[model samples]
Target: MTPAGRATGAGRVFPPLPQHPDPQAPFATSWWGNAWIGALEGTSLDAGRLARGRAYAREGHVDTITVAPGRIVAYVHGSRPRPYRAEIRMRTLTPEDWDNFLDAVATEPAHIAALLDKDMPHALVDAAERAGVQLLPGPGDLVPSCTCPDHGRPCKHAAALTYQTARLLDADPFVLLLLRGGDEQALLDELAQRNAHQAAREQSATTPGATGESLPGTLARDALATDYRPPLPAPLPPPAHPGEPPLLPSLPGAPNPTSLEFLATDTANRAHAYLTTGTAPFPTADPWHDAVRLAASHPGLTGRRSFSRQFAELARSVDHTPTDLSRAAAAWRQGGEEGLSVLESPWDPPAGPFDRARGALITADLPRMTIHHNHLTNASGSLQLRYGRDGRWYPYRSEPGRDDWWPEGEADADPVGAVTGMIGS
Candidate 1:
């Protein structure tokens, strides 16, 4: 199969460049979950880094190799210790077994384990064990034996591969999982089977064995008939206590509650509202962190839009709603020229003082926002840019040697002038 974002080349798959370059601006330095690296230990795979390694593999880069159960084996180019190739161990599933496994996985969702039985390498090996799968060491698991007499962990070629894979996995998780034998659906299926036999046993015990008979199919069907589902009882009125006032009122001597205070209290009632709901859009740093933390906590979620949707749902309330730009910006870190692009796309020309007024056309005020730009370079040469704010024209151009962004000074100077400077310099 072709690597993501790339076309097939002579029947061989080549890796594609990143589709989205900038993840937008204000969100650049998001440190959402303290455990992005730490948490990998609890799962069979480092869904995050495995993703990056897959991208490296696509480009045909020698730095990284991805395998089953979301394992990413990276080699150091010339670190020191060299690794040896293990005996080749190949297992081809029989047509029947493969079909049964696929069918079983298709019936449910995740299926990483049943498809592969290797323990995850790296710090996440423990995580894989917890999830009940072992990511194994096989061909392509490590670099070929190194000639270096030093016996260091990895030589230069292996080290280079390791760095490259680490960078790749940092960018995409799907690629990592693909390298693993199963995808999310496959993993979930394996997990389901582990508990399934217990459920079947419970059902058998509940049935009577006298006369060697089983519950009649028709009677069993009737027991679960939707038409016979019990009707939901009407909501009960708040209970009344003997001699209690008909309705709870403001404390006798306390001042009456104001709408604003009531709204504020309402927001506080929900979980993580401060991080979730706010009238202001998420600024670059904190917003993305808040978002990734949520996604990392919940698997199978991806893309910048997913973060936007989750944040909206988590913070859905009036008081927590950002009523003004100031309130919105408050949710993010403060910096000057940096602050301007807090709620804007990085792909667009950086937001200047003048753009602030234009935000009113979309809404009375701009919510905190950030534009993400991912600059990718590989066999494929595609540019990916995503903007957060609604109205604005983003300008982009190519510069030799720079894939992620234009040089810092160039990004800020007049486009015409910047081009001239590049030519002169």
Candidate 2:
């Protein structure tokens, strides 16, 4: 796709950009950076103001920027005696858009690799757009506001801030996610959630079942070109969710419509769950864990009634309490047995990880915390963490009026965020 401002039909420009004074490096060097600049120049009606803004940015008029969810703020100096507070606001993506974006990004492992290398590949952007996420700004996506006296859409100061922010976007793609309503760790946590079942799914796919059917594979080159699903105008599998069996008329002295609806909804949900993972929802090797897994899969009471009775019977046989089953089942729902281990077990970890985690917590400006053995607890003992064997921190809340800790939420790859997220919740 062409950058907004540079698109001249047939790839011809009436007048080309001037030669750069520095051939080795130029302002807005990255394609995304150039795209940002394109958005700015494409939408602005005053070319002279944009030129002045570029000059101001080059002359170091912009201050350090603080980027938040949907805004970037900085101080830009012009001919005026006092610096003006400049802001460039972009529309923050909604949760649905973010979900689609992350789904697209996760589909291609190379996309995350590209981000790690500080490169935003066009293919990743294309993938996101295909998923209905518009990553780069279009003509009106950027709304520049400034505290300056000038009445232009974007005064020179605001434009300066925009240019600097583009450089920032060029340097790190996470900055763009921030502008679009996602933070790095939050996005990572969510991506982790989506991938929580990924391994089990992959294993389930490759491992044959009772029938021992071989799972066939196809090359992309062959798959993309065939009509009979060989290379492929492939069959659309099944409908995304289970369709209702023929609408049944209720008979007297039989089940009511409400009961039938409940059964139908439960059946559809189970099928949807299966379709979602392409397998059962997170199976495990341990029988107890598998039982807990089954319980978690049935969500509402109507669906869970049978599982609840089974769990009660099993809990009695195992000499475990109902509360214990509830807690473990919650963990199983979050990710699987790994999540359960994070909750129920703790082992000694090397100090190296502890020290690194301590630094991150400090950076997050969390309440003062002290690490003890494999746990990190705040001074007041209200919030806490337990280091898992898997090198992730799991959040726990203090049992009110008691001296014990119980797991609260999913394990976080980021130690600081694990506890910080609890605070927000």
Candidate 3:
């Protein structure tokens, strides 16, 4: 039998769920879908209502579901002839909050890559949370309503609709993004555009003559003539007093003495191999995995702290601040090397006067060419100059607990002059 359609609002129609001879699956296969169900079950006060809702969902009572930013609407078949209308509304993130969330996502390529692969990593969600944008709905966020006479916050009909929606979310994670005020294509396009812009800026920074002025004849010739290969370090001499046995250094009051000795010997052997061969014996392409392997072999270092220390050391080697390393560590812990790479990857500065200024800085023969949001970072990644909305460039330096782009100097309209002055200082 064909179910009747009910007109809810302008051009919005809710069609009843098709009846099947066999009962449908009770829950979604995906973790996200299960998370939705968990959220629903966690909120309901009455166990009977939830049980009935599960039955209603399994029996295919839910109709075609419609989801929009901040709203979900559906119809569920019940004992009554007319279907019950159900709607669930979630408070959407504010424009500023969304901007901040997007900024965080843009900073890391892995976040977008994970979403593109239909996997929403917890790291991305945590980053959004830190940015004051709640991507996932919490207990109080899911506001449910139903036309059914039941006084429960989410009547069985509404619960059934939500359960079905979770199934939809399982199929397409972008539905959550849609609920968060952006369509899939729109978000992808925005990310692509941002990535491309950043790539272009990097290219411009690298290209020798892309800027208006060409390098000086002597300098260009000298640069071309210079040998770029690094000189290999001299091998260490054999340990003094070769006849004496090498002592295993022991930490005072250390536990597991034998294990510590083995670990120390293994570490020294590996270091010697790396020094002699100029390569790792068990080389891994992934630094995170390499660190984990090292930690596994060591007695004291293990778990998140070990991974974090390795990540911090790597970040420091690349001149990134501790704050940046902390974010990277969080991403790595949540999503491994892919997450770490995302955080490490430089994002393009937002389109504005900043891009032109950065281009000008590159033209002026400045080293290091990363443009992040309104800030232009030097090759060292320590010094930064930010372009303010007031049409002035302000200087900044990396400092712990001061992650925000706080300007330290007088603002100047001239980007090139501002950068030059900062560099000179």
- On lDDT, the leading prediction is 2
* All-Cα superposition RMSD per candidate: 23.4, 22.6, 29.9
Q: Please write out the lDDT profile of model 2 over residues 1-425, one tens digit for every residue.
A: 11111111111001112323442455787989888888888899999999888777777778656676666666575665335657777887776788788788876778877877888999999999999989999887888887666988788988888877777777788788777767676676666665645655676778777353556898888867756643658656766655432222347888654335335645676686787678975445576775566445433211211233444655565567655766676666555677777667667789998888888888878776788778888877778887877777888787544756656766788888788778777
Q: RMSD to the native, candidate 1?
A: 23.4
Give me the runs in candidate 2 sitting further than 4 Å from their true place. Answer: 1-25, 209-425
Decreasing TM-score order of the candidates: 3, 2, 1
What is the lDDT, from 0 to 100, of the residue 337 in candidate 2?
A: 74
Candidate 3: where is the Cα deviation over 4 Å?
Answer: 1-26, 212-425
lDDT of 1 at 235: 67
TM-score computed on alpha carbons, candidate 1: 0.23
lDDT of each: 0.32, 0.68, 0.62
lDDT per residue as tens, model 3, 347-424:
444586766876787788875557666567776556676555445666655553455433333447787776677667
Query: Please, what is the TM-score per model?
Result: 0.23, 0.44, 0.44
Clash count of each predicted structure:
79, 5, 1
Candidates 1 and 3, the one with greater TM-score = 3
Clashing pairs in 3: 17-63
Model 1: per-residue Cα lDDT over 105-158, one tens digit each: 333323334224332224343444344443333333443223324333333333
